[model samples]
Target: MQTDAANPSLKKTLGAWHLWGIAVGLVISGEYFGWSYGWATAGTLGFFITTVIVALMYTSFIFSFTELTTAIPHAGGPFAYARRAFGPSGGFVAGAATLVEFVFAPPAIAMAIGAYLNVQFPELNPKTAAVGAYLLFMTLNILGVQLAATFELFVTVLAIFELLVFIGVVSPGFSLANFSAGGWAGSDTFGLPAFTGIIAAIPFAIWFFLAIEGAAMAAEEAKDPKRTIPVAYIAGILTLVVLAFGVMIFAGAAGDWTKLSNINDPLPQAMKFIVGENSGWLHMLVWIGLFGLIASFHGIIMGYSRQIYAQARAGYLPPSLAKINPSFRTPHRAIIAGGVVGIAAIYSDELITFGGQTLTANIVTMSVFGAIVMYIMSMASLFKLRRSEPALARPFKAPLYPLFPGLALAIAVLCLLTMVYFNPQVASLFLGFMLLGYAYFWLTHKQREAAPDDALLQTARSLVD
Candidate 1:
């Protein structure tokens, strides 16, 4: 018997622009914050080189990932691809990694939102504001995808404009000497320490382009995802690459790049260095920067919910999480479930530290660890699908066959290895979560028969063609 699992309850209201907004919005917060942590580890020049390497990896990965996105268009995104490629075990690994990435990311963004708001009202505890943001945006996502996407597009545009304005204002103060003084990890010459610093900084550089692939989670809600997703992914990646480099360079050069390191609200601080704290430009950044953090926070709430819903529907998660709100046609249960975890993480900020890092930095590293694992699984899925299902209809193929996917896979593996070596505490936490998830999955998943492969394939083909 064919299952309705293929035809999900989500509304198909998102268009190309909506998908693009989700793609970019899911990652814009990186430009505003989190990425500065890389500077603390690698120095300006070292982190710059590290970002270049990470950017190249993302560029290649996105080019290769689009083929699977268009062909499957499943809400599970990477999880679905791995499931089809390697079976239940593979799907579990990808799904758990995606969950870690999406779930952990919003807490970090929420803390940034608090930090931004605290700029205007110092009396307001950032943690309180962070908890409030979780409540507000989770409610919005539960309302509907169209409403959420529209709001995301509007804020994403404003955030982009704000970044451009920031770069313009800071350009006057961009001093080459200030940026180059300690560029190579505060040493006149590069050495093994500098090399290790770059390796340690890979996660933070990854912060710049972390969740762009989350747009794939919205494929089921997009209007003709096969056509629209390719446009969104391609345009989205290019838009991010340019913005990532622009924000990092000009912000570093605006003042002593050293001062900007190890802070959450780097943009306003960078602007303050150029325009002074009392300048109207600095004030504008303090307020408008909220949009950047909000966009990513809201967009990720949407992403994690869809992921929970998909896995639940497929029997990988608790079945009750698959329930969609009848009135809203949204995953209300799934949305709230993820929000609860995010809020707990917000409260745990500062209380949970690793190796002298802040909550935001530690959580950011954890999120990146998950992202690297997911990327490895996704690229591997692409290669497997190409060989196993040659006739599968692909609307958009990767530009370079073995080169793009292979590069992404190789880099992903390297990043994961380096992260484990540098961050044993956070890595242990990540591994523990994965193992707990796998244990639960193995114990319970055997009780129920998952949807037949033939039926799901037929459904995916129907949706794609």
Candidate 2:
């Protein structure tokens, strides 16, 4: 078995503050967009019901998940935890699910960024802007970790402030009348369709807290694993909970939630309810909202690169992916590899429409598909490790022990079933990717090196010198 030798190669530059920033940064865009899609299916009030339920699940899920992250403290995050509890196949599935969540997410955001830019310059082709975003951010990440993290902190703070501004500027105009006007678009009453819509709204609601677990993926680079992960995780989720409900309720009241429901730029559209569509305030928000997209887009890139680098170094992917840049000591190859894949996803979405879903919405559902699977696996890992590895040196134990994890698992299973029932096409795509990744792993598992995350990189370092 490999030890903690993965530490020597990666820099330890992140503290609890950075961890908090990262946790918020990765999911802040959710506060601005995506959640509105729930309005389309479940209407305003129904979506609120969905959000409340999902919020409780996340509260329980994150509390229990911190136990696994703190005890294991691996860059592979849930994958490492699942691997310890259930072995190689479990690790691959968890890792692939994470790959699905983190890797597929950026293209969806890149498209949003492109759409935001389109509002500013109508002539700028969205596809071109998205590709450009990938290139610009990938280069920044390849340059250095501290530089990337600092940028992440800056934009995340900016985006948070902007959300506060939006709430303040739009608050006075909020009306219950506006909120309820389109409260039940598709359903006649609280019947089967309404119930299914509530269940189907799970993915969009989960989008509010999706990838908040990504904070765990940064465990390898954090200052103090036991202290930082707990403080950051707790703070991070509380912060998002406030922001999520704030944005959802306020935005819903500010305008007809149905109008902004399926649009790519919900914040700007919601502003139309308070200020005229052509108001300078809406224009300003469109400008600032770009930062919200960048915060998530940039932060998730950091996450995916680290995940890929960690897994590849552990022999789960090609050795080339684990290689680090000698000058910057950053995972340049992994970052570029992720960027390329994201750009490819962008073009593929433009080319095909799956299950009558728009490229952006389908991609978002695909990410949620991975997120639900990861939640189930990670919750199970926590439950199993608690019973099996009693003396695992947990610095921050989950509050309710078995109850918390059990509830999270049950809720996750319910949500997963609901998501599959509603979006079979996206679910199939997600499952197909998992099967393909696992097949490759099954064939190559025997050839893997018996080393920790960075042993191969160490060999390369020695050869270079």
Candidate 3:
């Protein structure tokens, strides 16, 4: 049997421009909406507090994270690092957590897409529109990586421009009084409730920075990952940080920050303050916002499919998932497989009611929970790999070393604890998902070849030669 890497394999066609597209494309939606949910928990100033802390964490995390990504440069991202540092079991856990993050994220973005469409066409059911969005994007992804990335680039550029437009339009209307309108949530003032609100807001704060790490997942597809990954990752996270803070401040001040706090389309709502509800600019924001969501939705599907391909190629998943399209040079089977799971999760409550909770509510919790796990594991792996493989020919090194990664690890652990405490039911659900992942690993993942990491790394080396 010719190995998967040798047959119908990934093509390294992505450069710094394309890599930046994938990086920003995978996370640009954060600027449009989702992050505002922190306001519901922490209020405007309180959410700002959460955003600042989470931003620091992602900053430290990304800087330290590039070191691992450049050194290993595998499609599995965090899994590749953990596997190198820990072994088969650790690798399996990291990969599974990654699947959780990538797999569920699309459906959440799909929900947003549906909501965005419903605003324009009130007759359309959100769920129906969501499923259609999935089919459209997945088909585009399966057709070719270059085409999909080109589309990603187009939409990401448009999305960023619209965001800048939003800031400019809202600047005159921005008010310090409105920004601090609801400084802290709940009936109780500054006490345990305020502190807990900040803690509870962690996941929503994370929504701003969620899948930025996903750029690293495209290591296998980057033209020159050693030079490209660090550039894209660093520049990408910084862009998002500025966007996150900018959008939050402008949106909060433009209108009733309370009303715009947590919704599918906060930008439209906030823009209403300046442009009026029926104005052309407000409508423009609504339509363009759909593209923003699509950018991340489409980009992350590409991210997850690569991860699915990597896991299957290594025998952690069924072999069929490793099938690459001979013409497109993309993992066609993995793309379809992940799309099916996303569609299923879209209607999971309808398929089998899980406590009557919406799929986005239940599923996004898992994605965030899983993202935190990958962060902690990846950062820890950074430290371990440094100690264990001091001479492992690293092309890019983290700027602050122990300080950068240590801040990342500590903040990640804090967020994980906050997520569990505030979201007990969903946290329980995440634990259940982990158990299922463990069961799959125990039954079929023993007898490792110890060659996949070396093989995956060699795939990166091949890009240069």
Candidate 4:
């Protein structure tokens, strides 16, 4: 098999801290927005319960997933783990899911970004601002990985600080009565309707910690895979868990949480209720809250591009996407390809609506569907690898053996079923996208075989072996 020397590889400059930034930054936008939709369905109390369940699921999932990431240390992340445990077809499923999660997520964030900007400058078209965000971030990614990562780290720190500020500013006016009123989907008690509302709210709860696993995609670029990845994943998830709960509870308690539901700028609206419409804190949130959106948007752009490049190099996608820019040592083609898809999704906001939901809500649910699937595959891969490759080098074993991964897998399956039952239209769209991608992989597998000596293809073989 051709060695890695022959394949175009990413530059290695990322350390534990940088990986932490990527991990948290990829999902930080969840705290700022996209999660309030749960309130529309589950009410404040019910959504809080949902968030707690989802947080536990993520905590376990991240711990178990760290084992696979440290061992494989590939750009494909979960795709590599599943490919080694199952086969090429397994890789395709994981890759497609990861692509969907990463690609579809940004358009939602971009639209949120547009909404935030529009709050300040009413004349600015939100769609135009969304597209501009795409262009600016894509250029930053194409410039280089280190530069992009550094920028992500900077913005992520700013975003975290901004969330703290939001929590503090809103704390003074927080009223438990305001939060608990109609908290159980406005029902008098936790009846059947409230129970089903919690089930229906699963996807929005997932939006809070959706893309934390994207950090694993940077394994190939990390300075030390085993050690650095664990630190990043652990610290990243902990930080996000604190911020997610703090922001959610404090924002919900600030005033009548019901009005914040169904809006993209929930933080600003929450602050406006606490303070006044013209309060400086509210204005600050509209402006500084953008760092949260930008962090996730930029970080996920890094993630999806690497996933596309890795799969293309392995013959799961078009070969042209695998080519790294000679100067930047980055997957320029892959970055631009994902950007184009995201930009198209941005323009389709009004063109694609379902069940009277806003474009952001629909897109967030779609992305969460992809994420839950990827989590299931990754957890299963972890189990299979343990049984099949008993001697595989595992620098960091899962702390609880079968227990951690088993819980994660179980929660993920339940979440998927609940989401599918609640959002059949979005679920159908997700399934259709997966089936279409699988069909392409099935038809093109043999055709890609004609180029047996391809260096990148050989590298893929060596890595899988």
Candidate 5:
């Protein structure tokens, strides 16, 4: 509903390219490379089918988000949009869900980094690796958003190059026989009953395709929020979809899908086999690409911090989080808050285990649910905004109007249902968190209503003027 006055000095100097670069960097790094390895278990065809389904879901979600961002074009993506549609209470749920989604992202990335480090230094402690990566990114984020964005751009280019090289080297060695060696429909490795195995695999697929909405969070910071945000959103999704499919096809061709499934870091292992053990140069490049995954984590923090700041300014969160650094002209407090959560997640992952599972599983489980909820809220907000503010100017309208958003909403619901049906424990925990968010909103609604309206007016005027 409002951008904080404390953040009034924050400027929108980021051009469309910068925004697109950040979005692509984040999606590719976070969802594409960082998490796609898990899909290896399903083999190439399974991975391909899953990727296509997830990519469609991703693209549809972005379309819905684009429509919302175009209409609102504020600091918070869903949070701000939901506030405009259903008032402060709805905003709080949206904001909290988004905050949870982002707060979990950094640590998940850190865990991935730790996993990658194990490739280079098999003897190193994963806990230490996680902490080291967290501290590095925390400092980068604390320095300022621009610095983070610049670093992310460099890392993103390198990461892309690394992936391209990987594809190039591995393509020649790919064996189609390896792909179809194991039946595509079922596998003994999963251990679950046939139907259960397929259901169990949904989370891995969902995780691989998450974060397309990261672009929407950068909407307010874009040079031309209206034009840039929408184009970047769609373009970013398209880029990742292509890259994901390419990587899957290449991976299938390069080696036995059954063997690749067992290797956690499929790219490096595949490369080592394809290019031979002496290809030290290619190995180093893979490591560089891992750093790009680090960059993706950085980008997610940047986008999510801005969303948190926007939520705080709009009265859905503690006002202190809205504070901006004069020099950086960014939501310094919000960034720090997000970094703190990330750091905590690292600690929790190091110390906690449930049912023989590590904290990464918990975080991933919760994050998926939170992400899905935020997405649903966003789609619902689109319909609400259309009804509430029919005259609202939208620079970019989702093609087919209601059809796109409706499809996205349906797919999101399907994902949620599948997640719940497959893993009730995580689904329950995530739902409990959602209910808590709603309760927090209910308790804060009166206070929010009593807050002065002038701040909202001022914030809106600053943006339009």
Candidate 6:
């Protein structure tokens, strides 16, 4: 009988640019917009320096992903790589971590959409707006991946155009005097409060560049995995980095750092300052950018569902989740399962705490912690693959090899440590989830052992050719 590895079901409809659109759609909006606003809170110099650090860290992450994706171009991305290197248990943990990121991100994006809409229509309630937007994206994702990718490409192009126009209009108002006023370490000008605030802001800064490897996760579905995956992964990161820096520069030029801190909608605020209050064109640009948030939520749901489906196929998750719909050829079961979990997450965040902290804050921090863990594991997988499968045909190898991977690992570890030390509540929650994953793995070990290894080994060896 022909093996499953010889006839996997996922069709390859994505090209290099389409894959690039997916990653850009996932990472470039939502939280990054919030991150840009957070920078204004710290002043221009502090924000600029911190953003550069975060961008470099993201570049390290991309390098690590590029190596692993090239070594093992499988449907599950990190989950598959971890299982092959360590075991089924490792794969489960990786999949769980990815689920954590995806489940929490949508509501946060919804919240941002709500906040932006509130800015435009001050009388509307933010929570109601957020839930409504979430429902719309959920419907879009259900239609299919092609629609999701197409929506993402449209949003990304519009976002880029809006950003360029914002920069062009705002740059002429440049004020070098405002550039170095506060300084990076938050000097005497802003006092000690500013210094600690910048340190506290690290996680939020890193969150902007969170999904840089999103394209690679969909590698198996791309038209030509070897060539397209690498191109999309690299190009997508470069595009986002450029856009981020442009926004920072323009915001710094149009208004003083203190003014930016008070404004949640920086792009609109900057545009208003440059063109004055009567400009309807600037308002339209801001509204277009807000729509990008909806596109982002749709892209994330698609990526997360695929990860869940891949893990289910490997027996790390229930087999029901592995079922693909014959008509759509999409992992319909997994998509429904992911949506249900996501809705639960959204409701859980509505609960409150005594200290003004909400469940949403806790979930966001846990997601960040989980992302850090996955990054370390994925980077280590690259190093392991270099030793175990040195003969594998890699169309694109990470530049600097051991050095780059080592640096990436070290930075990811630091971020993880910082997250734990800074917020023990979320850290504890992350540990608790990991423990639960371990217990589930223990229970499922027997099933994994009884399963055939022929399919798994064939999948691994295919990379060697």
Clashing pairs in 5: 174-253, 174-254, 175-253
Report the lDDT tens digits of candidate 1 across residue range 1-465: 222554347788999999999999999999999999889889888898899999999999999999999889888999999998998899999999999999999999999999998999999999899999999999999888899999999999999999999999999988878777687763433545478788889999999999999999998889998889999999999999999999999999888878889889999999988888799999999888899999999999999999998888788888788888877889999999999998888777554586889889999999998999999999999999999888888988999799999999999999999999999999999999999998989888653375334323555666443
Candidate 4 overall Cα lDDT vs. reference?
0.89
Better of 3 and 5 by TM-score: 3
Per-model clash counts, in order, read: 0, 0, 0, 0, 3, 0
Model 6, 1-465: lDDT tens per residue? Answer: 132553336656778777888888887664335665445435666667667766887886786688778667776777777777776666777767877776667666666677778877889886678778766776676566676677878887777777777778778787767656664534443455465446545566666676666566677667777788778888888888888777777676776655655334667777677788768757775688685676567777777778777777766777677676654556777777776766666566544221244444454565677677777778877877778778877778888877777887887787787668767666777788788877877898765665444334565787676
Give the per-residue lDDT digits (tens) of candidate 4, residues 1-465.
222545556888999999999999999999999999999999998898889999999999999999988878888898888888888888888889999999999999999999999999999999999999999999999999999999999999999999999999989998889888888873434546588778788889898999999998888888988899999999999999999999998998899898999999999989988789899888888888999999999999999999998888778899889888877889999999999999998878555587788889999988999999999999999999899888777888888979999999999999999899888889999999999999999988865564344433343354443
TM-score of each candidate structure, all chains considered together: 0.96, 0.94, 0.94, 0.95, 0.88, 0.88
Q: At residue 223, give the lDDT of candidate 4.
A: 94
Model 6 weakest lDDT span, ten residues long:
350-359
Which candidate comes out best when scored by lDDT? 1
TM-score of 4: 0.95
Q: 115 in model 4: Cα distance from truth in Å?
A: 0.4
lDDT tens per residue, model 3, 103-149 = 98899899889988888899999999999999999999999988888
Better of 1 and 2 by TM-score: 1
Q: Show where candidate 2 strays beyond 4 Å.
A: 1-8, 185-193, 350-352, 449-465
lDDT by candidate, in order shown: 0.90, 0.84, 0.84, 0.89, 0.69, 0.69
Clashing pairs in 4: none
> Worst 10-residue stretch by lDDT in candidate 3?
446-455
Prediction 2 TM-score vs. true: 0.94
Cα miss at 126, model 5 (Å)?
Answer: 2.5
Once fitted onto the true fold, the runs of candidate 6 whose alpha carbons sit more than 4 angstroms away are 1-8, 30-32, 37-43, 179-198, 259-264, 276-278, 349-363, 447-458
Clashing pairs in 6: none
Candidate 1 has its poorest 10 consecutive residues by lDDT at 447-456
